[model samples]
Target: MTPSRPATAPGVREPAGTVTGPVGRLSPTDRFLPLWIVAAMVLGLLLGRAVPGLDEVLSAIEVGGISVPIALGLLIMMYPVLAKVRYDRLGTVAGDRRLLVSSLVLNWLIGPAVMFALAWLLLPDLPEYRTGLIIVGLARCIAMVIIWNDLARGDREAAAVLVALNSLFQVVAFGLLGWFYLEVLPGLLGLERAGADFSTGRIVLNVLVFLGVPLLAGYLTRRTGEKARGRDWYETRFLPRVGPLALYGLLFTIVLLFALQGGKITSQPADVARIAVPLLAYFALMWAGSYALGRAVGLPYDRTATLAFTAAGNNFELAIAVAIGTFGVTSGQALAGVVGPLIEVPVLVALVYVSLWLRRRMTTEGSGRGG
Candidate 1:
């Protein structure tokens, strides 16, 4: 295991990670996530196109207005991520007020606005798709981002705090933000409004189902595991065993989504590209903007990387759930949400490399300035 760093102190220049030595190397699974996701996409599309009956069977298993297969996949994907969060460290992050406030503002305010603008600019004619993109933007990330931040050797404690903060905020803000951006704002912009229903009850329920259950499970698991096996054993043994389950669940979920929506994707290949434009742009723009802002504010490299990633990543699970719940299983909105992870996994992995390069460059510059 890579040695864990101490919790960040306010305005302190702690070592982010080894600058000259090999940092944390990727596990085989981490190295191939994008490839696995692509394979799952291909298999799902093939299953949907060839075995059309499968969709009906999976779609038939509904519970609480959510598809059973989807619900299970989501639970599996989310639980491991939440389980890893160090909720106890949230209070420690408060001392670094700059990092905390900057991350929150970028994620909730600037990130959503940028996505909304890009969706309108890129897909003016496709309201459902636009609304789907907006949903992606509003639901800030809490899960996979930990993997990205870890890969980049960022401030793990800060990442944990931000993830916990974002998860709680999404439960309260996502529905209202969805209504405001997808419905009211579009109407005010004189654009065709999305027809999907944005019910606060449904949104809250989905949050409870998707995030709340997993969070509680994670908390319980941590408490029990630590009590029985000690913190080091739990972190090294128990977490390692369970952490990759989330990725497995994510790949499985992708396959199901693609299988269900294969017909639409095949029929309208151009639409996939169209939906992708705003999403790709959103990731690039938000990452660049957040990185620059963090540098301008004189944050250290690790915190800056954390802020950039936290702002750039989206909780696609929540977005997909809301899209499917609001629209139907095969709605264009849901398709947009499904495409989010497909796009995100590859894009973020690449950005992990970019962040490392940035970190090295920034550190060298700082050294030169001191000299």
Candidate 2:
């Protein structure tokens, strides 16, 4: 009589052979992602505008033309996530054709198409905002996919693999997608007036400053951490320690972004209401599409939840940066970028509970195994 292999951890669900654990531990204080973001945004906006010459200061912080605050925020947000990934397991995923193919198809092909349709259906008249939405969609989830995947007790290994692969695709496809949707396709739609000046040189600089540098730093840090702390210590000790710092960085970034845009939001309160519907619809639709696709592929409930969230979540940080850099902060493109987090945080929290409910139902349906 084998003592029933300890129940899968609260957040982890695997096939019959594996052990599970709590996907994530959340306290009452930890539950306020969106609220915190909103607060930071409000404060940041006020500071940026009221302080006078703050933009110059921020611009001065640039390294090789990358805004320091944004770069720091992105690095802090991303490193913990990269640290969690087991680079050793990367090869296994590369070998698994099914996981590789599915993630690629979902992230690049189907996902962008869905976003385009939703943006068009929701804001056909607001071409700039629509284009901004397209940029956000093109970016895809990078850092936060780990959080969502963990929350759903997903196949962590699979998630790690998918994230690494998606990151690659995003760097390549994002610019191309932005060009197609924001530049080329708008002309075809007879919305040439909506075009924002896009700079290939600037985009490349951002990729290097925001993306390339941080990734290298994270990789080096992870390697050093593994060597010094060992695998278990790195996972348990280091990741947990860095998590709060990452959150703080996110909060700071939100504040700065809102500070920059506070007056605009205050002046045009109604724009929030207008954009809210489409953004909400976009989230719901993307999740539904991912869930349906996972089911069709016969993935287990946890994997299904991870896939759904990963597909639905947008990399608004990168999107917002690109929008502002390319189109200026006052442009409709910038407004759309700001609107993303306003919708995303609360919506993602709600989806967390939804996934939990779905998990229970799936377990029951499958007679204690995930369906």
Candidate 3:
């Protein structure tokens, strides 16, 4: 759940909350995001089960291996979130060499490895689901991380820069990493390779269409919006109106996804439950490990929180798009992608409080030591 206000350090409070707070302090829409997502899933399942020929109607038209309706949902879901990133602030974020190098190592390298290990370890029998989880790990986070950082009083500039960097790197790295993890690395480790074979070109096209196009559109929207109207208007007046669309888009996509695979999901409730275990473990391991790393490097609370959240969050939208685009819409991979947010939302919300509590404890202990 992202804040209505842009993710900047603010000293003044509005009449109600805007950019900062713990889980309870979030906006109503954002606060109940998990509810909305759950409701969407239920609705889609009902529609698919009740209505005959609905899936066929929805899939009648296709473009670039994605159904037209689903493709539109993906683009809408991604655009506003990507637009929220401050591409201009990379220099400011990069000046902190420790933060930059640490983020790259965590996001690019460690994040994927841990996810791959957990997915394989947990879901050795479920290749499609395992691949879906691995794709989730590669996505990195450019979306709701701003809200998570702000809630924990993290370095907004660092979140903005890291998110921005992720948006760009995703276009190039997503394909190569997918190839390595799904095919090469698995064979090297004597693990089962992915059941589905994906060509490099297909993965590249999926990324370009889902991430690249929206990234460019987001960059241009921010640049033009600020240049034409001042930053104040862009952030305050324009962004709030546009930001909600991302949620709408996300819900829309989920509905269509479940509609296509409703029977399969309803039949295998145990499968979804099985998927949740590794995801919970993944968040716990990533956050605890990254938070500890931040301290080991001698960073203070704000930068440390940013580092932890960035490492823990994943772009499920891109994962879903990749799964559906590469595999069929009804593939097991898409179902696993759908389950990502369900596990991630509540876990991350709890971790926000953990970060705040840790911050207070650190402050009090530091004061006592000084005295």
Candidate 4:
């Protein structure tokens, strides 16, 4: 079972240590992911430019039109996030109707609408990439929000429930939402429809492959490991070992992506920055909107932080998987999804600090009122 707080064992306090490198030094990857991602991007671009045949070789290593390297990377990226979810705690949120309803509204309704509007407003000339941005907007986060919530001192139980709910909800709602937002809505709005295969079957297949496999793997890993090795060992030892695989896979995927799309990326260097504009705007807007909404609704600081992070984050893994499955691995659409994480990690980390600062301010204000 998942602990109500940061996973700690009785008589064994959780370490307050920063992530250290192999040489016992502070690792840049732990403290600064964007730097590492930029490095990977440069390396990938160099490799692609140096050896033009490499992209072809990787593109050819596909099973049923899906790139094998990307698929494996997606699996690695997703499983650890899923495995950490405490599915058993999902039921506890039944009593907190305000948090549940408010979060769902923020995630499903307002979030997608803002993304669609921003993508259209920002990238009218870049339809394929705009569709990719829309896809990113549609997929509510199930992974990284947990980390953000923890950093912000959010309500852990509420975060767990929301995460589990979002995971199951994504599996069901993502395909239909993708079709509607990326396909039908754009058509209605007089925008050029995405020229990718948003077929229901393809969408479902991607979900099953990307989400289903990892979710099951995560559940099994958690349950079996806990039962065999005991919960304390599983939480402290097993999880710490496995958690970094997701980040490693993410870096690997970024390198492969930049390698394949190096030419396009180089030719239209400005476009990468353009793609990030709406995404950056969306994160800032969503976090502020959700935080204010939570406070207006009388939620305490912890739950408000939970609401804010959940609303702001996106499940870029699912977005990337669908983009690759629908539009080929090297397509502009897939590149948009790739850019999602590059912008997201740094922005969210900054927001975590902001959330902590807000928490302190709120506490101070409340104390003044009492005095």
Which number leads on lDDT? 3
User: lDDT of all predictions, in order shown?
Assistant: 0.81, 0.68, 0.88, 0.84
Residue lDDT tens for model 3, 1-371: 35654434467554564434575567778889889999999999988888868767767798777789899998999999988888888788767888889999999999999999999999989888898899888889888888888888898888898999988989999999999998899899888887556666787899999999999998899999999997888888888898898989999999988887898898889999988888999999999999999999988899999999999999999999898899878888888888999889899999998999999999999999999
lDDT of 1 by residue, 295-354 (tens): 899898899888999999998878877777777677788889878887887788789889
Deviating ranges (above 4 Å) for candidate 3? 5-21
- Give Cα distance to truth, residue 16, candidate 3, Å: 13
TM-score of each: 0.89, 0.83, 0.94, 0.91
User: Deviation in angstroms for 172 in model 4?
Assistant: 0.5
Q: Which scores greater on lDDT, model 2 or model 4?
A: 4
Please estimate how well model 2 matches the true structure, expressed as its whole-model Cα lDDT.
Answer: 0.68
Off by over 4 Å in 4: 1-28
lDDT of 4 at 345: 81
Better of 1 and 3 by TM-score: 3
Query: Roughly what TM-score does model 3 have, to 2 decimal places?
Result: 0.94
Residues 208-233 of candidate 4: C-alpha lDDT, one tens digit per residue? 88988898888888889888998789
Q: Model 2: which ten-residue window has the lowest total lDDT?
A: 1-10
